[model samples]
Each structure stands twice: as C-alpha cells, then as structure tokens.
Target: MNSVSRRKFFGLMALGAGSMAMLPGMAFGAAKAKTSAPGQTSLAAGQAMARIKALIDELRAEGRAFAADALASDNNAQWDRLLNHYFDRKGFASISVNAANLCPSLKPVNRMAALVRDLLEADISFPMRGELAKASLGHGLTAVKDWFGLGGSDAKADFLLALTANSTMGNNFVNNGLVTSGFMDPQKDNIVVWDVNHPTNYDAWMYRKATQGWGADSIRILKTKMFASSVTEAERKAGTIPSDPQNEDEIIAALLALVDERTKLVTLSWQSNECGMVLPMQRIVSELRAVNKNIHIHADSAQTFGVLDLKLGQVDVDSIAGSFHKWPCGPKMVGILYMNNKHGAAERFTPSIWGYDEYINTPADYGFAASTGTIDPNAKRFSYLGQQNDATLVATWMAALFHTGQLHPGVTPAKIEARIHYLGGQVQQALFKHLPKVFPDFTPKTAAQWIATPTSNARLRSSVYLFKTPDGIVAGDVMKHVYEQHRFAIANLKVMGHDLLRVSPTICNNAKDVEDVVAAVVDVILAMKKKTLANNTHTRSYA
Candidate 1:
C-alpha cells in the first residue's frame, strides 16, 4: 500500500465507498465465523460467539475496575465528588486520578470535570460496546424529546415516518424520499417521527410493504439508472433499468403526482452508486425547508459516524442515526441517533411494530422510551459472531471517542470528499489519455463532464467518476481488464445510464496511492487499444 501515487487514489475513488471491500489485499469482507449450511450444525459459529461473549464479560469487569481505580485516586477532590453525583457513578472520587493520568492540562477542579469525562470516555473507548450504548441511548432520548415537546402527551401524532435510503446515513438527513416528496412535514412539531437512512437500503422495502408499489420501481430510483413511466414490453426486452439519482427524483416526482402530501416518507440510503458519495444533508435540509416549513430531517451517518465531523444539532438536522462498526471500528451493529432540540417532535419516527410506550408521546418529551418488538424475532439481526447489542454499542462509543481524538480538527467531511473527488478526477484524466486506442469512446470524462449531460447536471455527479466507453463495451470487460490483466484495483460502474469505471478513495488513500492506480489503468487501456486494433485489422482483411 506504500509508495502508491495519487493516480491510484483516483482508481480507488472510482470504486466509491461501497467498493471498499473489493480492494486488493485489503478486502473488506466480513470475517464471519465459518458456519455450516442451514441443515448442519454451526459449531464454528457457536465457538466464535462464546469467545466474543467471554471477551465482553472481561472488558466489563475491566471497565468497572478502571472506574474504581480512577475514583480512588481522586484524593477526596470536590470536583470528583460532583462528577460522581452528575454521572451517578458510585466509584470513589476518581476524577483526580483521571485528571492526573488522562489529561494533565486540566485544573483538576470542578471546572475541568467535562474534560475528565471526555478523557475517561477516551480511555474506555477502544472496545465499542459501551460507546455504542451511549449512542443508542442518545438516539432514543433524542427521539422522545424531539417529537413531543418537553412534556409527554396522551395524543399521538398522525405519523412516525422514518425515511432512509443510500447515503442518507452519511449526510445525516432524510433527503431522498422526504425531499422528493416535496412537503417537509417532519419539523413542524406535529409528529413523533424520524427520517433516517442506512448505508444499506432499508426504507425502500418498508415503503414497498407500506405502499404496495412496484419494488423494481423503488430500487430503480435509488440506483439512478433508467427511467420510464412504465417498463414497457419492448423496454424490458431491451434490458433497461433506471440507475441514476435523477431517475430517483423522477420516480419521486411520479410518486408525488399520485400520492397525497400527507403520506409519510421513510427510506435508507447507502450504495446508491459505486461513487460512495455521502449525502449533503444540511444543504438538502436548507433547500427543503424553503418548500416545507414542517419537514423533519433525521439523517443516518452510519458510515460517516466517527470519520466525519458531523455537528448535527448545529446544522438544523433534527435527528441522526448511525451504525458503529464500519469506519469507527466499533463493535458491530452499534448505531446511534442524535436529536436537535430545536427541531422538536417532527423528527421522531420510530417503527410502529416496535411497541410504543405510553410514556413516549413524542420526541421532545422524555429521555427514555422502552419500546420493544420492532425487529423480527427469528430473522437475521445485527451480530458479529453473536456479540450482544449492548456490548456492541459500548464498543462503538469507545471507537468514536478514540477516533475523535486521532482526527485533526481541521479535517471535515468536505475535505475527505474533496480528496476522493480529486483522486477520481486524476484517474479519469489518465484513463482518457490511455484508453483512446481500445474503444474509440474510451475517453475518460470528469464527473462534471459526464454528469453535466442534459439529463445528469441537475443531479449529483455520481460520487464515482462515470465515463462512457463504446456502446457495446460492458462494465465487466473493463473490470476484468483492470483486476486480472493489470492488477490495478478498480470496480465496475453501471450507474444511471452510463457505463463507468468507478474509483473511490478513503482516509487510507493518499496522493501516491491514487497515481499507482491510474498508472495501471493507463497500461490496461493501452493494451486494450492494441488488441482492438488487431481485431479490427483482422476483420477488415477477412471482409
């Protein structure tokens, strides 16, 4: 991975965030415990689960000891006493010891208690279980207070819609369906609901279940592919599919045409395109607010949780949802949601199947709402070798604290985004120069140039650079050429209507990495060109 050039980063950027798993020698595949098929016993899975449980129990004990040791070292400091009171921890005056070991810069007095809290949190942050628990608690509490004002109400609002789709989680807002629907009703303090997006698609299926609309149509909008009022017999014969964000907007527009404004919108956003483009939710919210004053915006930042600086409350984002395992390195399945006090109940959108406690009349009313029965009892749930949700949540919280300490304050989501974009642009340039020989149209185009076409400009620049090759050249051809022949890491791009080579870069990518990828792409294009020329010559001679 070292000595790689910026060009290689471009290649990675094309693959987008979703393509992270496909990288060479750094496959993001989950190391699930080897298990037997459904009919066979899963001894391996069982063992893995047992091991994880044992580790969790040990960590819990360690955490307790650490708390006690820190408290005991406090030396009867009044500040330590206050923290114990506020946080409700029974351990001795641990604040003094924590101040001594964790952060010495602080005065160690009452004024520095917050710093101590942050530091102790940082120390315990490595194992995600506890941290993730905090996140879940935060989300739950925010849900209650945001939806129902400061007091619990017996009256329930009309809807509790959760909109999630694509990078909605990254952007921390429900932009897809909520924005597409045209009326932002969630923010007006009426309903106890939340709009969220998973990095994976979750809400679309829920929508299908609720609306009884065509599933293909729903997916087509999210993928941003082909667009038609209806897939005609001829179009089906031709193998058309909607695969662009604009197509999604069109689908939304269509849905809006027939649906009522009162209809609630919920969706999950992830892997919309290989570009791995995160949602620009704050901007979307601003735009949405102009049209609908009441629209609530609850975003899912599962992928961007610890990696990106998300001031959800400051940005007027009502609620935020996220899973801990992806970037923050927290325990698996740990997710959190942040609620903005200003947005109020328009952001509380819990699933109805999850039994609603009478105490949770709205989002702004309470800190805890014990609603259960939301998930399928027998269905597959979030588990990394059977780790318990509580433990996982804690681990995620620790990861967040650890990563937050590591990142430079200057680094923002916008910066990471620019870096990836720059890498993708460079790769596209290299490919444009090299691929001319193989396919006449192998000219690499910038995301701007490719997406700027009449149909794409109004939409996002597919986070991955999408360049069209010759009409007949399928995405698989380019993918195979890069991965097998050239050994350059890249992914197939079949987003919207364009066949593109998607490259994506993440925090791990640097300028050199980008160059290595581009150089390989250059070589592949040259070889392909030579082969194309030979084939053409042979065809001419035969004719």
Candidate 2:
C-alpha cells in the first residue's frame, strides 16, 4: 500500500470530489487497481479518505468535550493554563503588538484551513454548502447577540453581514437611508460626525461624490476637543484634564448643540482609533433621543466592538457598523452591520447595492401570479449580494466561537479586555518612567503631554496608546526605522495634525512585550536624533 502525502491529499481535496473523477491517473475502486495508470490511487486513496475523515471527526468531538469540561471547571489555574495554551497555538510573536490594525493570531487561519477541508468533503453538495453557510451565519449572529447580552429581550435586533468594509455599511446608513427616507432637505438638513474620526476611503467617496450628488452643503462634523494638547498648560500640570475628554458633560452639551431640528442624522465613532478615547455612548444616545425621538443615530463601532463590553440593545442607536478583522481576530473583508429593528429602524435604509434578493417578491413567488416585489424584512436582504466566500463566513462563526469560549473555554471577551488593558498600563508606565531618561531633551514634562491617549481616567483608556515622538523626528520615519531594525510592528498616525506613534497591545501580548516595544521606540528615536544633530553640525560648518 502506498502512503498519501498531506500536500497531495489537500490538493485532491481542493480539486473536489467531482473534479477528481476527471483526473488522468486516478482509480476509485479496489478491483481496478491492477489496470490503473502509474502514480494513481485505487485502494490507498480510499483508505486515506477514511483515515482523514476519522481524524477530523475525532478532533471535532474532542474539541467540543474539552471546551465543555473547561467551562464547567472552577479552577482558576486550569483556566489560565488553557488560556496560555490557546495563545501558544496561535504562534504570535511577543514583540509584534499591532492589534488595533489587525490581529496577528494564526488561530483563524488554521480554523479556516480546517473549514475548507470539511466543506470539500464528499457529502457536502452545492445546495448542502448553501445550507451549511446559512447555519454558520446564524451561529455567528447568535454568538454576537449572546456576547452582548441581547439574547432574549433584544430578539428584534438583527445583524447583517456586509461583504464590504464597515465603511460601506456606514454609507448605507448615512447617505442611502437619509436620501431614501426623504427626511433630509438638501438645503436645510445636515448630518453630524466627529472631527477626529478615522476617515476611510468610503468616507472620501461619500464626502466628495455622494454629498455632491445630493446637493448638500457639507457633512457637519463636531469639533469636540478630547486631546491633552486641547487643554491649557496649567490644566496639564495640575492633571485636571483627562486622557479621554469626550466623557465630560460640557463636551457632550457642545456636541448636542450642533443638533437642531434640521439635523436628520448623527454618526459618531464610539471609540476613536486615533487615541482610543471611548465616547459616552449611552449618555449621548439618551440625550439625543430626548431632543428628537426620530433622529437616526449611527455608531461607527469599529474600534470598540470586540474589545469593549458592549450592550447593543441598551444603546439607542439606529445602526452600528464594524468589522471582525480588528480585535475579533477574524478573517478580513467580513463586516457586521447591526440594525435596531425594534423601532422599524431597519426599514429606513434601502440596499445601496442591488442584489437578486432585492428584485424578488415576498414569500419568493416564482409562479404566474402578480407579485409585489419587496426586499426581505430581515437581515437576509443584505446578505444576498451575489457570490461570497462561504468558507470565510463559516470561519467568522468559528472566530466568534473562539472569542466567546465555546470553542475553547479558557478565554472570554472580558479576559481579553483585561489582558489588553493590563499590557496597555505597562506600556504607559514604561514610557512615562523612561522616555525623559533616554532622550533627556523630551519635552512637555507631564504624562498628559507625553501621552496622546487618556491617562487620568482609567475608564476611558483602551488598549490603544498613542504617544508623542521627538519633535525633530518624523513619526513615520521613526516607525519605519523601528520595524526595519527591530522587526517590531506598530503604527504611525497623524490625527488632527498631531503625529504620534500608536501601540495597541492585544491579548496575545505580555508585560515583557510592552517593555521591549517601549525600549525599542526610545532607542530608535535617540539614534535618529543623534544622526540629525550630526548632519546639522556638518551643514553649520559649511555655512
């Protein structure tokens, strides 16, 4: 009997069972072995299939039992062990802490590989694939609802899976909904957003193309100051200013002042990607609802969805758009759009991109009767946008399971949040204690001035820590030099004209990772500063 290589088996699997029949040197039955072509399979391929199938079944069952047992156990030590095991399996490096941009875990990648194998098995036909894909989507939605504690009472709220990024969903809510509802008069009506919100390519399209088409003046952005630089020097020294200033009542009041009878929609980033400043969502939503019950509130929850403990049902928002690739450690291009259907909020927006479902009538009438063409009343209406990668969708459900501890019981969303914040605190403390010593010329003295993120308020702080770079050095130049020299992955962003280095440590990181990143940053900045000074001295001698 010949042994089948793993690569060959997966290649056969990728070809699928249907395509395998057309291969030149292949045999399916035992009796045809003698007459089969060279390098072909007869009984060995069958045995390989059987062995692989058994292995898959055993692993799946064992995983389920292990998760159940772990969840049932009350031992904290056991829980910690399982958590470490999960992180170790991901094969993430400690020095690479860039979770704010994308998760570095290989768990989703491995799970996706397994899903592809399962999906290509003999029993799964095309129709069966569709059924399984829908089931996975349903599982993901249920997991999201359960995590947010919106299981029973908030049953009316539905989640729509967007094939595009979160920005498309935002556009659908802000531009399409307002235009379709006829609630906004181009001459008088306006929309409100944060001035420092992270602008995506879709935002550029909406602002330049969509708004221009509607003849609207401009999208009104709230200039709510939330940075340490926005405060006076005395306030910085006295520690009167918090890192996250958006939580203040005065800031909220000023934001609400921009909303008049003409304001039809208000969109806000629940957490700023620039500085990780978490907005007071519940308070903002409640006050906005008090002012106008019909106002459409859309939250760009890209930064806070998986990292923060969110109760979607509690917050009165028309829609919340986010993606799983960020903090959820899921596959890319998988976005979620949560529609608050309790108050008929889901019906306000028509589909921005038309699909086959949009043309179909209710009850899917295909007979000769006169049909009333209507889009689906549920989230399914947004899902039927042509062909999508079903494998990625199923992997998204697996990713959700991974986070909620259904797949592995040791790690939960709360634990992940705690780990990220703990690492974040370590980074903050290291920067505050060591930056001045390394450079000796480091200015702004106070931690408030040194750190762009919120330091005074613990509740407002997130895993994302944006700190100032040296004045003479460009943040981007320092970021590139650090990655090239030290292989550390961080971000350099300019928000509201302030260039800063962003360090977002996730659950996979440790205290040591934080210390190493801070130390590497200091070394890189110092080296760059010396080179700049030497060059300046040479130029001065020539002058």
Candidate 3:
C-alpha cells in the first residue's frame, strides 16, 4: 500500500481514520499439503510469515501471467485451474474463474480482484464502463444470488467489490445516503450523529452543512465525555458490564432524541479508532428506526468490520464502509463498502462517484439512461472510482479467507471477537491494578470502565486500550523509551486534547505481552520522573 492520492484525501477533509491473508498447508481442488517434515502439524510463526512473503512474490508473478494468458484465450477450462489453485483455500467453497465470472472491462489488477471476489461468492454489479467491462462485470455478478446470505434467509450484509480508499468511503456513503433521501438538495433536513470528534461520525457532517452553506438544514451532534480509568477497575472487579446509566442511554437518546420528519440521514461508527470505544449501534439503530422510520442510517465500521459477526440483519444499517487492514490483518489502502440492497436501501443510496455506467443493460432501471449517466441500482454504483491497486484488491479476499477461515482456535468472527476481547480485558484489568501505583497523580473514577463494549449480548470488545498521562510526562518520550528499551511498540497518540497511550492485543499477543508492556510503561514513567528529579536537583544545587 502507498500514500492515497491527495485528491482522494481532500475529499475526506472530514471522516475517520482508514486503517489481507492467505492460507497455509493446502492447495485447491482436493490437493493435500505435502509434509515438509515427518508428522508436521503446522509451520512455525517465523516460517509461516516467511511463506507469506514468498507467496506474495509468487502471486504477483502468477496473477499477472494468468491475466496475460487469460487475455489470449477464450477457453474457460484454461484459466479455471490457475484461479482455483491460488484462490481456493481449505474452508471456503470451490470457485472457478473465467470470462463468465470476471469483470472484463477492468484492467488486469481489478480483474484479479474480481476473481478473488468470485471465490468469496460475491457477485459483481459494478458500474465500470467498457463494452468489455460490462460483460466482464456481469459474468461475476450473475454467480451469487446474495453475498452475505450464503445460507438460508440469513438476511445479512452482502459482499460488493468496492475498490475505494478508506476515509473517502465514509463520506461517500453518508453524503450519498443523505442526497438520495432528499436532504442534501437544499431541502431542510436534520442530520444526527456522534461528536466524539472522530471524522467519520463528526466533521464530515460538519462539512456538508457548514461547507456547503446549507444553513436551513440542522446537524445535532451527540456529545459524551471520556470515562475515567477507574471505571475499568470496577467492571473488572465486578466481572460485569458497566452500569453507566447516565452515559449509555444519554448517548443513544441524544441521537434518537433529534429524530423527526426533518431528519433524513444519520451516520455513525461501530467503533472509535482513536479510543477503543464501541458504541451501542444495535440499540442505536433500533431506537432510531422506531422514532423516524424514514431516516437513512449508515455506519463507519472500519475498526469493527472483520471483528463483528453477521448481525446486520438485526441492525439493518443502510450502508457500512470498512477497511481490510486493521482487524482483518490484511493490506492497507483498500476498503469494502456494503449497502443494504436486500432491505430496500438500494434506492435510498445514490453513489457520489458515479464515474461510469455499463453493468446493467436496462440503464433506466438504475436511474441512468445511457453510457455517461445514472448510478447502478446496486452498491456497485460506488465501485467506479478510477484506477486501483489490482494486487491489493484481490488480496482483500485472500486475507478475508485467511483470517475468517484459517486463523485457528478463534476461527469464526464470533470466536475472533472472544479472543480479542479476552486479550483486551487482560490489559484493561492489568492497567487498572498498575496505573495508580505507577503514577500517584492518576486518580480514575471507575475501576473497569474502559472495558466498555457496546455489544452487551456479544461481550465482544476491541483489542485496544487507552491511558492518558500527566503534563510532566511526555507521552512521546515514554513511547520512545518503551520501544527502544523494551522493544514494545505501543502507540502514543493525542486525541481530544489528551495525550494518551494506546495498546492493542491480538492473537499475536497474550497475557505475557500485556504484562511486558505494563512493566515497560512503569519503567518508562519512573525513569522519566527520576531523570526530572535529578535535573531539578542539579539546577537547585547550582542556583
């Protein structure tokens, strides 16, 4: 992944932070893993990582070669072997690729991505132009009836191939939803969202109302203060969820409280990237719909995309945009946007980047008349952003399959959540015990409050934890000492005027990792204080 184009970035002057995998030991079409060593159950981590590097080199070469070979021949049998070999993993259903299930108009990179998506059973309804592109895209789209609902009437969010940058997708979804709901057309509409100062939930709404000089429509922001470190202590000790009677309800009511006929759209986040705060989206959507049935709801799920399960059938959000790199452990600079076309959100979502229109034969069906006009009726309307990294795009599916399929013990999304929450809870509990003694000035209000995860029934928390230090202790200096001395690369960030320490615990991390980081943090803070005292003593002695 490389720097996103400034043009694309400027489009996100407000929104949230943007943030792939493959399998091992197995091949496609009933191929078995040959034993490298006798009775070898699995490869070592170092070996596994090295294999991934080698695999990337192989994929780049083989993918390009296959595309080139695919170009010269029209035979489906020829390319099917190559596609199935690289794409087919252990857990997923078998998939084959050819002109019938590939987006023809796409450049080779995008075509490879289409093949990966085809393996994931995500149909293509993209709006990219080319007499060749339309036919190519449709071949892939016609494969799956529903991407997310692979089983019975599961009614989940579908998989659409959206080759977009992360921050750009949030604004795209929100603005498009608002526009389609007749809010952004100078019609007076009230937009309600969170004001944690995160770009996705906060400032993008600000730009639309303030930047566009639309003074008639109102934007009410839901505001909340950061909970104290003590809160985490109480929750951990009690071994229960926080009873923040005032905080949770207030946040939900504040947004739903603003709903009325004038309210046309509401955009929010599933998790805050800066703080590991998970909002009660399930309930927030539930209450919002009850109040204003017409409000178009969109969620920025960059941090929670691969972390959360297929519960969208309950939340019923109109649109969700997320990145592959963060929790999914995939590459960066790639984003996935899912729309609720199954539940009638298709007509309500108008693509902001309606760059091309060639997927559907009846253009009028999707509000487009001809080649240069109209958005696709499906979420594919948003997939028309110009050129994209083909390798990274295709790798998204590979990474998705790797994590959701191959990441062991905690394999499914539900299991993954449990592992992360357990790790995060460990850090939360340890910090509660260590922070006070480490910094005498630190007096938190709640014991285990930061362990707050909004999904009550799921108990699925983010793998991230945050702690703020006083002015005398520079967070960057502490971060430097920890990284340099202890080899612990903890994040030192400034959010909402507070200099904070951010820690993330994943499958790669465990209780020992948390203990090591806490110990390092204690040493760094104490060392800084000792150095400060010595300097003060030297200055006084000289004075």
Q: Choose the strongest candidate by TM-score.
A: 2
C-alpha TM-scores of all predictions: 0.45, 0.75, 0.64
Candidate 3 lDDT, 1-543, residue by residue in tens: 122343233223111111011122233222232334766444332232233334434554544444433211223343244334433223322111111011111122333444433422421212111212311232222111122223233332123434466745755565645655454553466676765434655766677677666655477655444543223333333222232223455455445545677776777767665556666788877888888887778787776765656466566777777765555555457766766765556556566654432222233333566565555656666666655543455455445543343212123555556656666666766676687766564433443343222222224245556666545777767766676677766666566666666676554333566777877777778877778422111111000
lDDT of each: 0.34, 0.58, 0.49
Question: Which model is ahead, 1 or 3, in terms of TM-score?
Answer: 3
Off by over 4 Å in 3: 1-161, 180-187, 228-250, 356-372, 406-410, 441-445, 448-460, 532-543
Clashes of 1: 113
Clashes (candidate 3): 25
Q: How many pairs of residues collide in model 2?
A: 1
C-alpha lDDT (0 to 100) for residue 148 of candidate 3: 27
Q: How does candidate 2 score on lDDT?
A: 0.58
Compare candidates 1 and 3 on lDDT and give the better one. Answer: 3
Compose the digit string of candidate 1's lDDT tens values, residues 1-543.
322332243223322322322111121234454544677432342232233333333433433332332222112242233223223233322211111001111111122223223433433222222222222233222232232232232221112212121133323233333432334333331211112123234444345335633323223222323322234334333323233333444333322232223433323232233334344455655654654555454454544443344554445655555544333333433344344444443323322222211111222112223453232111011111122334332233233322222112222344433443444454445545555644454333323333312123323321234344444445446555656654544555444345655454333333444556656554555555556522121111000
Q: What C-alpha lDDT, on a 0 to 100 scale, does residue 75 get in candidate 3?
A: 32
Residues 144-261, candidate 2, lDDT per residue (tens digit)? Answer: 6666546555352234333344444554544554566456665667777676566752264256446456545446656534455345444433223344463466446556766777
What global local distance difference test value does model 3 have?
0.49
Q: How many clashes in each candidate?
A: 113, 1, 25
Ranking by lDDT: 2, 3, 1
Q: How does candidate 2 fare on TM-score? A: 0.75
